[model samples]
Target: MASTTQTKSNSGVEKHADINWDELGFDLVPADYMYVTKCGKEENFTNGNIIPYANIAISPFAGILNYGQGLLESLKAYRRDDGRVLLFRPEQNAQRMQIGAERLCMPSPSIEHFVEAVKQTVLANKHWVPPPGKGSLYVRPLLIGSGPVLSLVTAPEISFLIHACPVGNYHKGPINLLVEDKTHRATPGGTGDIKTITNYSPVYKAIAQAKARGFSDVLFLDAVTKKYIEEVSSCNIFIVKGNVISTPAICGTILPGITRKSIIEIALGFGYQVEERVIPLKDLFDVDEVFCTGTAVVVSPVASITYGDKRVEYKTGAETVSKKLYDMLTGIQTGRIEDKMGWTVEID
Candidate 1:
């Protein structure tokens, strides 16, 4: 944890939040401000600005409240050792938000607008960004249909906002996952590939049950075939067998995670044959290692996965491939190592 002494940032702002940095977790610890913008259903989003973080008023008939029309994107800003702040591939998040927006029948900010809003929001709450290695400032961008409507049509207005909070590891360490065979996360031609608000909460029942059984999360198989593995409730899954790395292909079923994409490129650069194809659940028992990737989980190794009466354990520790990937990824993200790929954008 960083010293609690008062300090100034490069932007002449407080260097840290008053809360105990050592106690940071994935939970929200509201920061000082957020970014917000609104647009009519017909107009494109033109601009947004920083605003004090607080509860947003929405009508009871708002589409987000009534029809669950919303999309969310997550990214993080890291305070480097030298006190510089960096964001990893925020444009990817922007592109993804546009994809989700189109699918949900809503207008989205362009990539430039999205990136600028994120930069402003992060710099505005620079103090909420934890000290080097302590944690990161988790930025959440939400695009919602905030307009009131009584019918089943798209709302008259849309909202795009970004909020952030300092966070520690989403999962404390290596996680245990339960294979949900009965309940499915998404069906064919559904909203699985996007980060829409509706794609999450339905799985809460399965996750709640898994947690009660002492598992960290739940993994869902493909809804149609129920044979191939899809992804976890939140992150994308990967399996390592010998020199090959494989993950479920994004066939409009699995969320195309930014971290998952970067990890694949990194693995290929390391001379590993990476595959995006159907991964049978049975392969879990034959794999040498298993790990998951996401904005929140990063690259968490799978300690154990339970399917039916069977359970398979994977390699975990500092010597694992996941650890190496995590190190390289975080190194590039935090400026501890040269970001040869130019994936990070520094906040001035």
Candidate 2:
């Protein structure tokens, strides 16, 4: 638990909310404000406004509701000991959302527009940022087709909004995975690489089944061949053998994770040979370490993986590559270590 502080809001009102930062989980704890903007089919994104957090009104025939035409991004704001807030590679998320919007035939906010909206949202909810090393304010940016449409067609209007919540680790500890063979998350010619809401909802059943069997998450295989390792349900997978680290290549079937890309560069800086190729399920049995990386999970070690009736376990208590990477990444995030990579953006 961290001490409560009374902070003034944008409206000049003092807010004194007691928050248990250390006990925060990956749940949505509504903040004080959110940023919202909208655009028509031929118009660029307009200036956004910071509004009180509340439910939004939309038409029932909106493309987002009728056809699931939307994209979302997840990033975080970290509170440093010096009372500075930092955003971890927000431009990357902006670019990814642009790509997702293009894939869904929807217009997207420019990188500058997107980043500015996020900054405004975080600033409005600055008091909700957890204490340094305790947790972070999880920022979610969403773009949806807001125009009402009856036939299957591109949306005529779109809206973008940014909201945040204080969150801890998505998974509690080292997690166990179940290899999925029946349910496919994505395919070669599908919207797998994009962060669309439609891409996520279809996998709910598979994940529910995996959790029902007492596993932490589901590890998906390639949809077509079903022989190569693709990724976990929500994160990218990597395995370390000896001094080498390998992960599945981003070939339209895997979402390019910002944390995954950072870890690869960090590992290379540490003189570890990094390989991006097709990893087979059999390779996991011989790997010394396994882990998953994403915005929500950060870096989580995989304790064991069960494929069918056979289960393979790895070492994951303390001294491991995953732990080392997690420490380095979190250190850079919280300003405890020098950010030589220039990945963090400081917010005023």
Candidate 3:
């Protein structure tokens, strides 16, 4: 908490001393500090520190010198109305990063280290935290193969770093998406369940095509039958029918988003039947509503969906449930709602 002493200016706008129970939007200039650490082929994680954020020198044979061995996680920090700094379920991001690290045959940062590093980074930039309601800061935790070697095979040298930016909604409002039955986001026994870099580049071609056609995102289907839904490039998909909520099961091909899980729990609490099973694209045209969940989108409604030659429209283009869920989430995040799940962690 910032000191409770409040400062008053001549115009009558008061400044918070230590505790800021209020939050306002900020214009983010990247914080001046960051945390970095490295690990060897056989080692676990190494100790590191926060330093001035700037340029770095790298060897010609860095592990990421190749193309596929890297991973990242994204989340946010808020400066609430009273000037309190908070992180929403940062431990989930840290745990997901640990899983992603291991998927690439790299070292995993202990959850404690990951959370501590995030707190340290946020504390280092407390002054830069925009006020509440202005888009919050986007925190990105990245891991890359830093081992110095020139080869196509995976060897040791892995590294971790944390960076943040003041950010807003990824997509401002209801978005149009295309059903992708052609390409695969991840293969069986692949890194689909993890948030690794190698897993996402495969969709660039599909994503490019969709954007070219004016679609905001791609709705990927199952790799096998090419019938059921998977997820968007950066989010998990959900469809609501009256009182029921449906999403694709985590059958090893989806990112198993943290937001997805939280929404499911919230929906259940609201007396809705949340089902996790195979969700076919056919359901979209017939469902009551549909939307997406992610660290970025949180919950963005789907007004309409377009494929090559067909479009699926819903009566209630704006989903009542998704909007409610989003409100519940942001409410908890901004300290206006209860934290029943213990997701929010106060930074200061």
Candidate 4:
């Protein structure tokens, strides 16, 4: 068994799991506990349990197993230098999950219930949170159609679950992207704007191809136009040109990322013009910098993008917009800077 050590935290004396903080990465280092709740179709979630983390069994014909009726959200808990744990805009994540649950036909948890459950899970696994600046504890909440239903319909039962893991940066440094002309991520009026589980796996092949070709991820275009940039495989995309910042609008195709929304606000606060519109592919060649935003990557500067025979490189380093935003965002997240926006929830 791995050793454990006691530490004085905001949640009182807690036993921390023995692990190497310096070698943390964006992989699952399973925390000790998880949160789970259940509801019938059209019912509201009320009661939940904090259980030890382990494998779960489900029916073979369950809705999530057969018809892809599931939604998920990702948020992080940061350990401050003062031993306090903070969660960044978890209410936004709760709202997003509620929206996605409606689309996926699963019973949604109330925002209060959802946020409370997340807090319980994080506190239960408080020992897993890395030290300040070492990494963070990644909290993932999932809503799934747990009841068995062979027909193509909503399951009779729904489950809301939350789990956590300690992780580092999703991307180590500046990343290169391959613009995928084919295999669109979502169509008009689809579940792209939400965090549905079905929205992810279809792009695995494209991302795999990009990784095989020495690229970090694949950048997809709008399904309807095929010429306008939509998003990276897992995050939202943005470009900087002159004094304006442009990103694809959340027009039922791109996920409205929490980090992306936060960055837009920060940019406007810094006196930069921000535009949410359809960004054309050719515009990448003229941009000064490019970056992606999501819960995992946070803010990642794009080193270059390859489309067909042409490759366009963008600006990266300390002087770029992404770096400045990253510093401010992380500073607020880790308590290095004051959270003037009141975006963080202090876990006691």
Best by TM-score: 4
Candidate 4 TM-score to native? 0.98
For each candidate, the alpha-carbon lDDT, in order, equals: 0.92, 0.89, 0.78, 0.91
Question: What value does the lDDT take at residue 224 in candidate 3?
Answer: 81
lDDT for each residue of candidate 3 in 201-269, tens digit (9 for 90 to 100): 789999999999888989988888887888888899999888899998898998989889888988898
The C-alpha stretches of model 2 lying farther than 4 A from their native spots are 1-16
The digit string of per-residue lDDT tens for model 2 on 1-348 reads: 223467654335444347877688987788878999899966789888999899999999999999998998999999887767899999999999999988888888999989888989988888888767788999999999988999998678899999888999899999999999999889999988999887788889999999999999999999888898999988999999999999999999999999999999888888889999999989988999999999999999999999999999998978898899988998888888899999998887
Model 1 lDDT tens row, 1-348: 223346776556465677878888888787889999999999999888899898999999999999999999999999988788999999999999999998999999999999999999999888888988889999999999999999998899999999998999999989999999888998889999999989899999999999999999999999988998999999999999888999999899899999999999999988889999999988898998999999999899999999988999899998888898889899889999899999999987
Query: What is the alpha-carbon lDDT of model 3 when measured against the actual structure?
Result: 0.78
Clashes of 1: 0
- lDDT for model 2 comes to 0.89
- Clashing residue pairs in candidate 4 are none
Model 3 TM-score, 2 decimals: 0.89
Better of 3 and 4 by TM-score: 4
Ranking of all predicted structures according to TM-score, beginning with the best and ending with the worst = 4, 1, 2, 3
